[model samples]
Target: MTETPLAPPSARRSRSRGRSQSPRSNEPGQNLHLRVPYITRNIPTYDLLSEEALDRIEATAERILAEIGIEVRDDPEAVRLYREAGASVSDVSANAWRVKFEPGMVREILKTAPAEFTQCARNSANNVVIGGKASVFAPSYGSPFIMDIDGTRRYGTIADFENLVKLGQSSPWLHHSGGTICEPTDVPVNKRHLDMVYAHMRYSDRGFLGSITAPERAADSIEMCRILFGSGFVDNNCVIMGNFNTTSPLVLDGVTTQGIRTYAEAGQASIHLPFLLGGAVSPLTMAGSVAQCLAESMSSCALTQLVRPGAPTVLAGFLSSMSLRTGSPTFGTPEPALGSLVMGQLARRLQLPLRCAGNFSTSKMPDGQAMQQSMMSMMSAIQGGANYILHSAGFLDGLLSMSYEKFVMDTDMCGALHAYMKGMEVDEDALGFDALAQFGPGEHLFSTDHTLRHYETAYWDSALNDDQPWETWSEQGGIDAAQRANTRWKKILAEYEAPHMDEGIDEALKDYIARKKASMPDAWY
Candidate 1:
């Protein structure tokens, strides 16, 4: 906690002194303090459920935990830990241990989890304070396939991963570098976490997610973070966030439990959630699915407090509706969107931060369907007071692929939405009373002092959203948004200059990764 503030992106500082200090930007007009894209909710949150409905859902979740019980699978250590934490652990199945909580266990333990905590970044200016009125938009995670700029769909490689990271770093609206932007299939499964962590640390100074595939990977992520941001800094501040997904149908798998335990015990933050595919993971009804998800997420969140009281946790909703006709999972559906709004209300009732799926689409390409579907989900998150929006961009085809164009488009959407979230300034200056009087009827405001002063920041401008006359548009070759994004990404990569990192620290990271890869045999997953 005593770590120095992070200097602005433009401020060059001595890392040996301390990495946490924040310094003003060297740019004449730019404010160094305004380093990353972040939003603070100034308007009331959109509550979808009535009080009666919310009360009923909470009661049902408690009942589900008490009577229906949840299966804690495959981890004896977790089973034992749950028993020690006062949940009734049973011996019905070796692999699946049935755990039923006593009436007040979940609610009581929930008291220890914090509502808000600071998620530190390498550049202190980019550090995010999650929860409360804040919302941080991060890129997509866990997509094995990537759609390249040339419109080719291929398995992701380390190069593809680095490209995504660099794009994420340069993005003005993406606040966090999401873990597993695209799964690097080219890298060995066991050691990819190291490369991914290195990418996050080297390419971007922003905050990012930690590993969750296995406890060892999670441990490696934590250690690597400690090396990047001093040991004193990592232990005292939350430098990484691990998304601990709950297995659907009310099961806490071993890997998830390990991820939660290791991250919590290390004083890092986590998004505790359940991935629900309606009809497959849970019931088709909204009420039924919400109850199951709340029970599963809250139970594991409470478990985090048991492992380390006051650990920062985000209540999450990743419930996707199933396409009844095809029986495949669907995103941006009415059901999941409605469920997310209700989930936000539920998390608010508990006074905790909420995380949910964002910028999602079932489309394979960045077309009309993709844009519309993604906007629906993102609007839901913004309206619902979601504090941490995961998979916020680049997601497509039911989370199977990360698209280069979608990433750019979604970030543009995020910038506009964030501007919307700021709400209009209703004060006298903003009213433009003088401008109205001086300009009179038919007068121009473009050259007016008020217009010139605020014009640069009054509205959000898109790097890829074209607003050109027909003649100019035709002269520019008439490319679509995807094509424009393709052009932009390539330019950004060519001009990419990474955030500063000390040579010794960078070498240390390389050494650490080299040792890690050498010690383990490549097990391609």
Candidate 2:
């Protein structure tokens, strides 16, 4: 990439640019910053996994599949495919089918899979390729409100799809445009998943997160990505799908697992997310809750590895506590914060990527509480060294809704946290011995030529935080973080521009969705 020229010292001095003048009375101090590593130390590292344990887990999973078999149901096409692959099947009912697994088949599937994947952004420089030393971030799962052009908020709709793609295009931090933005209610139910895939490809020049309604639909989604980026591109550390709901021992479903197998066979990385509600689904104690989550996630990971040995998979454990009184999932609770730290440690032990939730808010609007919770949670995940952090933005009330203000706040917070994780740089220029000499002790560095030369290199937090005094804050209407976030949201939306796409690619995506819709069975619109 070409580098931009730096501004001259004199020019920088005249600009009067530095940290925001707003008083940071509410800013957490140095002690708060120290908490990053403190929480990180609580979890165990990846080195804990013994070679023998990994082997045992893999072997045990294969035996479980071969001996016990997986229950497949409500999808005849999936049943037929498994049977054709040499699995035993029983037609339990007109709509249900069960498949008996063979250990060898699982191994065969794993061999062809890729170990890493990459999600290319519109700007190639910002691209996030997963499966190696680095980690990537995705927008939070399942948000309901979508930001519109008029600066108004409404329920997520097809239009929100366009806006989200545009936003993803603008954000270098977000690696992929995820599914489940706004349900394309106007589209047929079976075809809605396909429509989302098509929209992501055409509207944003980034890799996609796959989650179609069924196995066959997942195949179509993979194929679309393949056609856009080329065959095996989807397998090359680009595509990822969450195998959720199916991995829960208490609520194992057929359709989600079918999607997992389909993606696994296609060589895409399949991350098994075992979501447990601490007070409800599992034990209330943090350790016991985490252990339960570990068992569930590890079981799924073991199964995926057995189904496809050495297949690129992640251990995803989402343990949120449920509010016993309100019957709501409370993401802002302290238990989830602790759980993510532990889960990150477990992933490290397994020598696999760990996917955890972050930037989650329970408040209906972006507020002080929202900012505090989101930042704290995200810092925990990053400090714990999670490989892929999901649900990084636009979520609230435990993923049931999204707020535009909160999304923008998250963007700013993510930017700052990412800066924090970069730690300190130690180049000769950064040492600033010459600059130190230029501005001796007892002298102000602000007016020195050396300070002027390098001032822009310093990190500056965005508007979500202000460093003004109470007097200044009160004069400015005493606006809290949420009001400021809303202002930022409006500003970003005002400057929003659509990304450039390949000529005719948009038309082709629409045509493909139309053809798929036309081909679906009458029962499925």
Candidate 3:
């Protein structure tokens, strides 16, 4: 593994030259820290059921699996793995399975786990320590979507994987580059997994969340991270089994459970996200939907804790809307927005780091609707105190599409929220006691030394938004926020430079990936 190069003392000095303009005062940003001690809560006496009631819910889930079972049409390997794992199979068909995972088995898989994990960034300066803090950190880009360079449209593509990693590295608000950057349909399925992993390592040295594509792919992704960051090194901050989709009613599929165990044994964190579609798969009422979502999330968190006590895990609840008439997915709905707010508060009650979506737009373009929806949803999550906000950017149309302009806009929004979360400052200096004494009532402070010294530090600066008069705005480009965002994106892409890796490390990663590909059966790809 290549160690990150340290900056020379002179180089550090040069970077700090102009930084005194906004000196790090004895402020909360420097001194304050929020911690979430545990990931589970005592079952609320009201919500808690008698042992008999608990048995009923578990029995119902078991019956659903035995009768309905889950659909696994995409991967034959998944089918084989499930059958081998003792799941009942369908007659004649080799793909389907009726998996009945015992509740105890699920509990055993979650005990004795670590409480927090650390994620390394491209530069050692940006590494994020997750799980232990009051909030976990992850990047804005993830959803299965792609944005056009023209900043007008979006489509899905494998190139999104590379671009998202780049954006993740540049985002101070984001902590980890989530896995599954669009679907790599252009490449072979098995090869696509390795390709995405390689892209993340090359483009950004940040921690990643693993996908539930296939057990083999999941295992390979972890192994690749191990090779790059060293075994146990990557494990500390990485989430191995992420977004394990439950077959609603709270049953875990065999393949999903397999991925969870694989990561658990490797000593990596796991997150369970019960993705529910309200008004369709779940109840139409927001409270009812949230109740179900919370129950499912708790079940998974409890199971994870039972399997490995303190196994660093997150409670992720993504409750979105499903059109009743059309049955199509809907974004920008009040249900999800309200539900997410409640979920964040609930996670706080559990003393667990919560992962929810924020700054996500359902609009296909960077228009007023997009800004409105994104801001509304993001504020709800942040003010509600969501620990980790995922899919924070580049999303539209229910997370099925992306826009470069929208992504840049989201970056700006994220910066604003970060400033908001920092909250009001109260100190003798902030109170302007000396400045007040210098300039009495009705006197101007704008020209004062104190104001001149701290104005920039006192507030956030937005690159894409301006409140200038129409005459002045027209004299300039008179462009919309999206256009300004696009310009900023280009500037960042041109100027940003990642820290260099050691000699031959890049080639070693490529060669290792090629060798792994060669070892796999041809048909698998």
Candidate 4:
């Protein structure tokens, strides 16, 4: 191949200025960039597998479902539905049955599901599209502990949960308020879901996930959404979602299947996720793990369609590596990232939206290790084409603890991703012919008309990064990124403002929570 020669600087300077430049009247501040409700990727998704390889994976998943079968424990209705839908069901125990499907049955059932749908928020303007090219970032869910800003690791409380919700609301990068940002150990296990759902409604107007611990809790979450949004709106449109995990090694417990039915029957959305740990619950190889994940997720997702056709469903895969010597779970590894990329391809083939990797880390602190691991996992999700990303921030201690500083730092990275996913624009102005014409060789183009026109929005500015000279940084107490993140989160919480809610709705939610709490005794596990 022959290389093209570059144009001479003198010739470039002779080119005409394509268009005149105009200065923006109100220039945005460094930190005051635009906030998007959700990201629509302009760049193409990274497909790691070819068509033949994807077919082989799908065929393997089919074979697994047909031969191994999944145990539907304690859910007779689910087993009955499977039997009626042409799947073979046999009694394994008093309340458990083994269900097996043919090669194409699950896929045929999943065809009833919509490829994409809208999840409305209390503020209609903040509503989000949950499929196709859209990508929504939500805070982490189900952390029982917290790494406090004071550098102490302790159990999370209701106060901590509420504070995390406030921080999510304040962040411009996050679109969804997220569900169960942390477990409130201070409250009763049965009643904490009520409080968590209420906090998301009160503090943020963005859409969020709901409780899925039990069928009743799932119903309660839907009822609360009915109160916030009108009953008619709640029934017709998806406003809330439930993230349900299937028991690994091809087992779908009754409670999980029941919860899936509850959300689907109510016309709500549900994410069918299988947490596959390599060399433990699943095979050591990535390809085998992918097949197993596909089989489990497809079975649960098909159940949603059995309950109600056209229900919104997302196929999710959470693949993790493990320490072979100690048998502990690992996160943010390369094997799982490759698995995520393949999952994206499978989801597209199934014509369902995908929810894949996120800012995952096993590090206990929000340090270099945490950030490095997070980038590896997070980039997989972004490039692999996940639509709704849970655990986008505040994940630490392998998801056992939520770190405030990590939350802020991750949000700052999410801000950068907003620009990264936008790709680049190529137009008459972007070519910079005008700038070259305005300036000659050996002269700076900083003061050119084109520079001023696009300067403010040209690049993404980091809120936690330090680019000052070493002496300046040292004079300022030599603060590091974690320390700076700590200060940023505290400042955000101090100035936090809750979104508006109607007086009647607020009272109704409060009354509902009180009644529910009084109905049950405290149970701490």
Show the lowest summed lDDT stretch of 10 residues, model 1: 23-32
**Local distance difference test values of all predictions, in order:** 0.83, 0.59, 0.59, 0.87
**Each model's backbone clash number:** 8, 17, 19, 0
What TM-score does structure 4 among the candidates reach?
0.94
Using TM-score as the measure, the top candidate is 4
Cα lDDT for residue 152, candidate 3: 38
The whole-model C-alpha lDDT of candidate 4 against the native structure comes to 0.87
- lDDT (10s digit) by residue, model 3, range 301-396: 544454345566767777778778898776666667877776665654455666776766667777889888877777666655665567677676
Regions of model 2 farther than 4 Å from truth: 1-116, 120-124, 145-154, 232-243, 306-310, 427-433, 469-478, 521-525
Candidate 3's TM-score: 0.77
Per-residue error (Å), model 3, residue 215:
0.9
* Whole-structure CA lDDT of model 1: 0.83
lDDT of 2 at 420: 63
Question: Lowest lDDT 10-mer window, candidate 4?
Answer: 18-27
Write the residue-wise lDDT of candidate 2 on 204-227 in tens digits. Answer: 544457764677888887777665
Against the hidden reference, what TM-scores do the models get?
0.93, 0.75, 0.77, 0.94
Model 1 segments beyond 4 Å from truth? Answer: 1-37
Worst 10 residues of 2 by lDDT: 31-40
